[model samples]
Target: MDTMRERFASVTSRLLDEDPRLAVVLADIGVDGFAAAARRHPDRVVNVGIREQLLIGVGGGLALTGLRPIMHTFASFLVERPFEQVKLDFGHQGVGGVLVSAGASYDWPSGGFTHMAPGDVALLDTLDDWTVHVPGHPDEAEALLRHAAAAGDDRVYVRLSVQTNSAPRAVDGARFSRLREGRRGVVVAVGPLLDNVLAATEGMDVTVLYATTVRPFDGAALRAATGLADAADVVLVEPYLAGTSTRFANDALADRPHRVLGLGVGRRELRRYGQLDEHLAAHGLDPRGLRERIAGFLTSAARA
Candidate 1:
């Protein structure tokens, strides 16, 4: 699995092997690779072709019957269509299920506006007790999923970006809580955009905090990590137009004092068509744009 999406398949495939209660469902929009995995694990997998709402409802039902259901669908279809099911069957009733939403952000050129999910994070943030995890790469996805299995949570949304992976460095889930400590500035990154951040500042001294889980954000850790910054320049990277992580980070660390610069799609009413790479790049998401943003953020913070 060269990409994070494939890494998710790897981890979920393992989980499927161990737990009979664990079940994976692929939406019609699922990738061919994951569809193959679902094929291999038929007894433990469910496929609802193009029916995201029914797919989510079935997942909720499966979870209600005391089985773990992992539902994979396009981000827009998963959130927009199944909002009622998510709020009612999933969040309101507190059913256990993992909603894996792929094709976040631009949705590539192949998928038009109907598939592009630029506002899923904002939608999920409004739901009570619902947890959202946007891993920038395979390592973080593995760690986050390990955390999900161990803990008993109401809902979890794992976001997958089409970009390359950038989250394998901190993989051990046991030592996961220590990842957001002893840093001058906390560089909060969401989705695969962290890859751009990692690539932009290769071998730099910046501290990166990858919070796959969005709702119960490690508030204390975020504060501690950023509060002590004598030269605080908290940079948040996300792929969404509204940037869920950046908004959450700002609200979370607001009581504490720190300088913040959020780089993402940045409040554009998205056009009907574009490539993920070009779309992100147009909004300062490429490697070069990321460098300029981080550099300017630090430079401006130094002046302040």
Candidate 2:
């Protein structure tokens, strides 16, 4: 199976060949992957080396010159490290660009906390007009990237992670698409968590909704699906930090008193370096762990 990173390189190369206005800016990451693209379009594909700050600055400059800049790097460096650049260079300057991030959350646990960015989306939420796309698989990633590139500088953030669902669904980024129908509760699977969420809710009387886009939150779609039932149990299974969407969920269900569960990576650092599955187990993000927590939560909701 192709990874999100692989799809990204392929799409970016195609964009470079198709759109003369498209320029790719890299901060010493994924440079070798696009060597052919860089060779073909010398003026379009640029590697700025380890300076993420300048990496963003160059993108901002390219945007000013009427070029659509696609910036790539690790999530930590792309979003957190050069946040000021992101804020001012793109936001303050009124220039739009696509910011694609790899090593989502703790995808690079071997690299430790410095390379991780669990709070990237939370940080982006503080800004305006940023479309966050969290695709669950390589196909979804490719589709979302194409959407962003065609969107024309609407301040897009494409988050890529090592975790992936078994396959891609016919996901439309406009709203949350309901995958399963039930009555007891609703489970919103954001990005890569679809597989885990489906496994957790198997044989249960709960609805499942899949989302490739999270920033818009799709409150209207959520309300329509759940009917805004009072005290309805709604669980949000995200790949990033737990409770990140608690506020959004509260806002969506503000009309009624509902029980919400936000399951994902814990806020505290795991500290130990290991494989991705080890980290998932440590955070209780595996299928079994998610099923246990979700099942228990549903039981309690029913009792209440």
Question: Over 4 Å off in model 1, which ranges?
Answer: 31-43, 172-186, 199-207, 270-274
| lDDT (tens digit, per residue) of candidate 2 on 46-154 | 9999999999999999999999999999999999999999999999999999999999988878899999888899898899989899999999999899988988768
Error of 1 at 264 (Å): 1.3
User: Candidate 2 — which pairs collide?
Assistant: none
Clashes of each: 1, 0
Clashes of 2: 0
Best by lDDT: 2
lDDT by residue (1-304, candidate 1, tens digit) is 4665777778888877787778887776554656656666776787788887888888888888888888887788888888998888887767888887777877565677777777887888788777777776677777777666545644777777666563355643322133433334557665566667767766545666665555666666566666656655677777775455666567767776666676777676556466666777788888899888777777676677
- At residue 201, candidate 1 shows an lDDT of 61
Candidate 2, overall lDDT?
A: 0.89
